[model samples]
Target: MAVEHNEAVVLRAIKDLVIEPIPVPDLKDNEVLLQMGSVGICGSDIMYWQRGGNSRFRLEAPMIIGHEGSGTVVKVGSKVKTLKIGDRVAIEPGTPCRRCHQCKQGAYNLCPDITFCATPPDHGNICRYYKHAEDFCFKLPDHVTLDEGALMEPLSVAIYACRRGEVTLGSKLLICGAGPVGMLYMMAGKVAGASQVLITDIDDNRLEMAKSCGANHTINVNGRDKLEVASEIEALMGGQPEVTIECSSVDYSYDLAINATRQGGCLVAVGRPSGRTLLPLDVALRKQVDIKGIFRYVNCYPAALEMLSTGKINVKSLITHHFTFNETLRAFETAISRDAKAVKVIIHCDQ
Candidate 1:
């Protein structure tokens, strides 16, 4: 019966989370059951816990609340061939309808009928044992810990943003927001052969972290206005940036990204702000900037895993705090606190 009961971190409502026992779902022919090892607390997870949604998604029902997870395979369904019991893997939360047009076009991330974990009506993998399609679980290499495996979700975001921005050999770039996603962008840009990458944020600690992760220049826009920061970023880059990635949803960041980018450059927006935001559309139009939007990622898990396995991207330093599965509430609190010193908080579920 795949054990008996599965313990999960469930969010019944705003500011309400309880560890409850749920049934371990029966495995499908192509599914594998996982015993969660680690789950990273993302900004969306915090929003879901605090106010029941992150903007576009509103929670209407109690749900298991986690999407970034890694686990050890406890069992495999009869038809599962790629993985077996005892395999370590990272979970890809989104399962798109394979028959959809977007899926066939290799843009499955855009599938309208995707079932994403923890996104209301959809149960997540934060429990002791959870079943998932074997194809969605990527095996982790020996050196990559489960924590790093969990991080593949956000790393995929950075990879997608960098790809959309066309960061290539000797490209000059500017990234706004030194949070987890911003830091990952800095590393991804470097990996894409960007010669100069400058990043800006309102936090000094995050800027330092950005530098450590390969940002050529770090700007702390704490007390400065957006125009001043934009000028400063241009000065740091020695010229206008060829690509600008806005990872922070701050009001002024959109303006900075639009104005800071060079003529004919690209601006990719990855962060989702809560409400309507105004942008400097005139400036972008005059510059002929290619403004793009990134929603999650498509076909990026394998690339992210390869980077981790090759030691090209080190997400270990980003993990600043760790909590036991029992302390899931505390972990969420730490992540929601926006403590600049805390880059990433991980919940170790192996206990």
Candidate 2:
């Protein structure tokens, strides 16, 4: 039976979110129609709803907003050979033009012609029914739940960031921010064989969560001086970290990361800042710190899935709340509320 109507969570404008019926178009030759199972609310989705845009992308018109998602294939196009009906899969979200130089170089995430879901001018997969390119969807193992499947998105980001920072055996890692992504970075760093990992956040509750999830140490940086925080991080980790991943977009956190990293170490900036922000360039230069930025992720989905399947990385603790598809507005509210302490909010789209 072909589905006709698709109910989606759409951002009409700044601070405007509504559930509306949208068209479910016919699948293209290389596409598959999905009955979305789970969709995790990202910080970017909340930002778009509240501010209409972020630093790099803006909401030019109404757009459905969700990127971290998993679904069951209800239909497949003629050219799709790897997936079939009833296959549960995690969506990779971004589709790059294969002919692009970046794509050819295996850095498809940097493809200038890429179309990323939930980004401005591109619709997302928050709907009851969605269609995506077959190649972008990875089939989940029987042991992997849809929720974990959705989490592959953020885990991919963490894995890529760790790779960028050169996390290795006995490496010391410092993660600034104990949010969902930050926590994942800590876990990924540990899995990558970092001997010690320290995570800092303003929220004690989040820091506590990080400690429970395998951080070597956690610190609350609220109202603290950046240099003092850096010193404390080094003292806690026994030395300046070889890699510092800044997951908090705050300028202070960036400075802390730069100040806390060892000389010649890598500082990977994973957060999306709102606008131009000043950094301690003199300090970074004097320390010979290598600053790197990641756009999304490249060729990391397979490893993310393997980690999940092997039980090497457990993301179950990060899922703090769940809501049915119809209660998406309330879910968003909970995610944005300070009291909610929501880490990752999953919408059961199958409902």
Query: lDDT tens string, model 2, 1-351?
Result: 678778899999998888999988688999999999999999899899998997779899999999999999999999999999999999999999999899999999999999999999999888999999999999999999999999999999999999999999999999998999999998999999999999988999899999999998988989999899888888888899999999899998998889999999999998867778789999999999999988999999999999999999999999999999999999999999999999999999999
Give the top-scoring candidate (TM-score).
2
Pairs that collide, model 2: none
* C-alpha positional error of residue 21 in candidate 1 after TM-score superposition, expressed in Å: 0.4
Query: 36-94, model 1: which lDDT tens digit per residue?
Result: 99999888888888888886788899999999999999999999999988899999999
Clashing residue pairs in candidate 1 are: none
Model 1: how far is 229 from its true place, Å? 2.2
TM-score of 1: 0.97
Best by lDDT: 2
